[model samples]
Target chain A: MNFPSKLIEDAVTEISRLPGIGKKTALRLALHLLKQNGAVTEALALALTRMREEINYCKTCHNISDHEECSICQSHRRDRSLVCVVEDIRDVLAIENTNQYQGLYHVLGGVISPIQGIGPEELKIESLLSRITEGEIREVILALSATMEGDTTSFYLSKRLKDSKVKVSTIARGIPVGGELEFTDEVTLGRSILTRINYSQD
Target chain B: MNFPSKLIEDAVTEISRLPGIGKKTALRLALHLLKQNGAVTEALALALTRMREEINYCKTCHNISDHEECSICQSHRRDRSLVCVVEDIRDVLAIENTNQYQGLYHVLGGVISPIQGIGPEELKIESLLSRITEGEIREVILALSATMEGDTTSFYLSKRLKDSKVKVSTIARGIPVGGELEFTDEVTLGRSILTRINYSQD
Candidate 1:
C-alpha cells in the first residue's frame, strides 16, 4: 500500500517487521499513534530502546534480569537444590504466578528444534550442566512443553546428567484439572492410565 | 501476567497501550524482539520516535505529508475544480488505490460525533468551505463512510454550503462488487434500487 508520507512509510515498515504484525496492522498502529499525545510515542520508544540496550540476564539461571542474577535466583527462601528447567523467561513467569513452586529456575531460552536451526548448543545447556556439576542440585525437573522439541531437549539433558548424582525428572503430563476424560486426546489418556497414581489413604 | 524483569515489564506495558494489543500479546512481541538482533529494536524505536516528532500535515487539505502541501494538493495532473472530502489520510489512500477518481482530497480528520465530543469546529470543515468559496472548485464530493457520524457530518456540510455556487454530491451507495444480493442488507439494497443507474448503451 502507498503511504502519503515518508515518515509514516518508514514507521510502518519497521513495525511490520515484528513476528505477527502485517503491513495493514502496522499502518493502523502507526495511525493510532499519530492520533494520540506525543508522550505516548515517547514512552513507547524509550521503553523499547532502553529494554533492548540495557536488559540483563541472570548469570546462574540464564533468565532475564535487571541485575547479575534474577530475583528468583537471589532469593534465599527459594530451594537452590531444586531447579525447574524451563524453555524461556515466560515459563519462569508462568510458574512464578502459580506460587506453587519453591525451587529456582534454569531457563534454556528455547528448546531443541532442528527445523528452526536451534539446537542444544544454541541454548543455555552448557551453563545448566555447569550448575548441576557444582553439586548443590539434588533434583532437576524438566518443565518444558510436551512438543517434540521439548522432548528432544529433555532427552538430551537426561542423557548428559546420567553420570551426575542429580535425579532428573519431567513434569507430569495428563488431562488438565478441569478437563473431561472424553475430551482428552488418546495419547494423553493412554499415558495418564499407564502412569496412574494410587489413591492415598487419609 | 508476571514478567521476569523490569525492562520486559516496561516494554510490555508500553507496547500494550496500542488500541487492540493486550498484555499477553505485548509480552510475546517484546520477547520476540529480545530474541532478534538489537538492530531491529533500534530501528523500530527510531522510526516511531522520528515519525511522531517530525511528521507534517498538508496546509491546504490537512492530509499527512512530508512537505507544507501534500503531493495531491500540489499536483497539476489532478483536477483542481474537484475535491473529494474524506475523514482521514487512510480514506485518501483507499480512494487512491481504487484509481477511479482523478480529483484532489480534503481530509476532515474525523466526522462529527457528539457522543465522542467531536464537533464541526474540531474538523477541517471551515477550511473546506473557504476552499469552495475561493470560486475555483466546481464540485465537492463527500467521500466519507456510510456511518451515523459520516451522515451527520455530510448533512452539516451540505446545510452550510447551500448558498455556495459549487455542486455538492456524495459517493453512491449500492451493493458492493461480487456481493450476493441474498446477503445484502435491507437498507443498502433498498438504497441501491432507489438510486439505480441506467444500463450503459454503446
Candidate 2:
C-alpha cells in the first residue's frame, strides 16, 4: 500500500516485522498511535529500547532480570535445591503464575532443535550442569514442552546428568485438568493410563 | 501475568495498548522482541518515535503527509474542479488505489457523530466549504461510508451547500459485485431496485 508519508511507511514496516502482525495490522497500529498523545509513543519507544538494550539475565538461572541475578534466584524463600528447567523466560513467567512451585528456575533459553540449528551448546545446558555439579541441588525437574525438541533436550540433559547425584524428573503429562478423555489424543491417553497414580487412602 | 523483569512488564503494558492486542498477545510480542537482535528493537523504536513526533498533515486536504501540502493537493494532473469528500486518510488511500478517480479529496477527519460527541465544528468541514466557495469547483462527490454517521454528515453537508452552484453527488450504493442476490439484505436490495438504471440501447 502507498503511504502518504515515509515516516508512516517506515513505522508500518518495522511494526509488521513482528510475529503474527501483517502490513494491514501494522498500518492500523501506526494510525492508532497517531491518534493517541505523543507521550504514549514516547513511553512505548523508551520501554522497548530500554528493555532490549539494558536488560540482564540471571547469572545463576539464565532467566531475564534487571540485575545480575533474577528476583527468584536472589530470593531466600525460594528452594534453590529444587530447580525447574524451562525453555525460555516466557515459560518461567507461566510457571511463576501458577504459584504451585516455590523452587528456582533454570532457563535453557531454547530447546535443542536440530532443524533450527539450535544444539545443546546453543542453550544454557553447560551452566545448568555446572549448577547441578556444585552439589547442593537434590532434584532437577525438566519442565520443557511436549514437543520433539523438548523431548530431545530432556533426553540429552538426563544422559549428561546420569553420573551426578541429582535426581532428574520430568513434569507429568496427561489430559489438562478440564479436558475430556474422549477428546484426548491417543498417545496422551495411553501415557496417562500407564502413569496413573494409585488411589489415596485418606 | 508476572514478568521476570520490570522493563519487560512495562514494554508489554505499552504494546498491549494498541488496538486488538491483549495482555497475553502483548507478552508474546514482547518476548519475541527480546529474542531478536537488538538492532531490530532499536529500529522499531526509532521508526515509531520518529513517525509519531515528526509526521505532518496536509493543510488543504487534512490528509496525513510529510509536508504542508499533500502530493495529491500539490499535483497539477488531478482535476481541480472535482473534489471527493471522505471520512479519513484511509479512504483517500483506498480510492487512490482504485486508479479510477482523478478528482482531489477533502478529508473530513471524521464524520459528525453526536453519540460520540463529534460535531461539524470538530471536523475539517469548514476548510472544505471554504475550498468549495473559493470557486471554479464544478462537482463535490461524497465518498463517505454507508453508516449512520456517514449519512448524517452527507445530509448536513448537502443542506449547507444547497445555495451553492456546484453539483453535489454521492457514490451509488448497491449489491457488491459477485455478491449473491439471495444473500443480499432487504434494505440494500430494496434500495437497489428503487434506484435501478435503464439498460443502454447502444
Candidate 3:
C-alpha cells in the first residue's frame, strides 16, 4: 500500500475509510479522480466539502436536511393532523415512495438500543411528545422495524402516549402477501393463525 | 432521482461519474460522506481539490508524479539500463508487487486504440523514444496485455526500437502453473506445445 507520495497516500487512506472500500478500490478511485478533468474532480470534492459544511439535522424531525426544518415538515400538501414516527430518514423516504402516506413524518434518528448505551433520552422522544401535545394530531403511527430495539421503543412510546386521546397503531406483522402456505415458517404461521380474521356471516 | 436540493443532486451526479458507481451507489457514497466528521470529510475533499491543483504529468516517464521525474526514474537502486514499458500506473504497480522486476517503468497512460481515437500522439510515445536513446539501455521489455490493442502497441514499439542496440522481448505466454490441461483451451494448449521445454539432464 506504499503510494507514490504523501498526498496520494493521504487521499487513498481517506477513501479507504469509506464503508466497503479497501486500499485497492480507494487507490483506483483516487487515480481515476487524478486522471479526470480538474472541474469534474473538484465538483466531487466540493460535494464532500459542502455536505460537511452546509448540512444540518432537521430540528423538528432529526432528519438530515439543508435547513433547520426538513422539506416534509415544510410541505403544505402533507397532512398535519397525523404524524408517522420512524427510526430514520430512510424510513421516511420508504414511506414517501409508497405515495399512500400523506401524513408528515418524525425521524427518531435511531431506535432504543440499551446495549449501545442509548436510552429514551438520547432519541427525539421529547420532541415527539412536544409535537403530539400541539392538540391537532389525531393519530400517531409507530413505523419502527420489528427488531428487539424497535419493539422496545414502540412499547415505551405506546405506554407514554397511552394518556393522550390520539390513537396509537403499529404497522401489521404476519405472513407476507402472496406467501405460500407450505413455505411459511412456523413463527409467521403461528402469528397469522393467531391474528386470523373471522369471515363467517352473523 | 429528484433530490430535495440541487446541490445534493449535483454532488450525487458528479460522484456517479466515477467508474462502477451508479446513481444509487453514488447517493450512498455521498450520504456516507455527509455522515462523516467534518474534518474527515474535508480532508478527502481537500485531497480531491489538490489532486488537480498540484499534480501534473512527469515529462520524462509520463507517470503521475509531483515533480518532473517520477519515483521510479529518481530511484538510484532501480535497473536504469532496462526499461519496462506499460499501459498505465496500474501495470507499474503490478510489476512492483512481484518484487522481481527492478527496471525503470514508462507509463503510456493508455494503449493505441484507433477505434477509441487514441492515436500514438495521444500517448507518451515520444518520451519512450527519447528514453531509449539516452544510452546504456540494454533491454526493452514490452510488459503489455495480450489484447489486440496491447499487441499493436508492442509491435509499434518493437519496430521503432529495431535500429537501437537494445534487445527487445515480450513476456512468455502459456497455461498458468498448476493449471489442468483438460480445463485449458486449444489456443493455450497449442502455445504450450509449441514452446515445450526439454526435460533432459543438465
Which candidate wins on DockQ? 2
Better of 2 and 3 by lDDT: 2
| Residues B97-193, model 2: lDDT tens digits | 9999998999988899999899999999889889988996899999989999999999999998888899999998899999999999999999999
Model 2 gets an lDDT of: 0.92
Clashes of each: 0, 0, 0
Error of 2 at A142 (Å): 1.5
Worst 10 residues of 3 chain A by lDDT: A1-10
| Candidate closer to the true structure by lDDT (higher is better), 1 or 3 | 1
Q: What's the lDDT for all of these models?
A: 0.93, 0.92, 0.82
Candidate 1 residue-wise lDDT, B1-202, digit = tens: 7666889999999999998899988989999999999999999999999999999999999999999999999898999999999999889989999999899899999999999999999999889989988899999999889999999999999899899989999999999999999999999999999999989945
Predicted complexes: DockQ each: 0.82, 0.83, 0.55
Q: What is the descending lDDT order?
A: 1, 2, 3
Encode model 3's per-residue lDDT on A1-202: one tens digit a residue: 5556667777788888888788888889988877777888887888767766777777877777777887878999988988999987667767878889999778887889989888998889988989889887889999999899999999999999999889999887788889898999897798889878789947
After TM-score superposition, the amount by which residue A168's alpha carbon in candidate 3 deviates from its true location, in angstroms, is 3.2
Task: Extract clashing residue pairs from model 1.
Answer: none
Model 2: share of native contacts present? 0.93
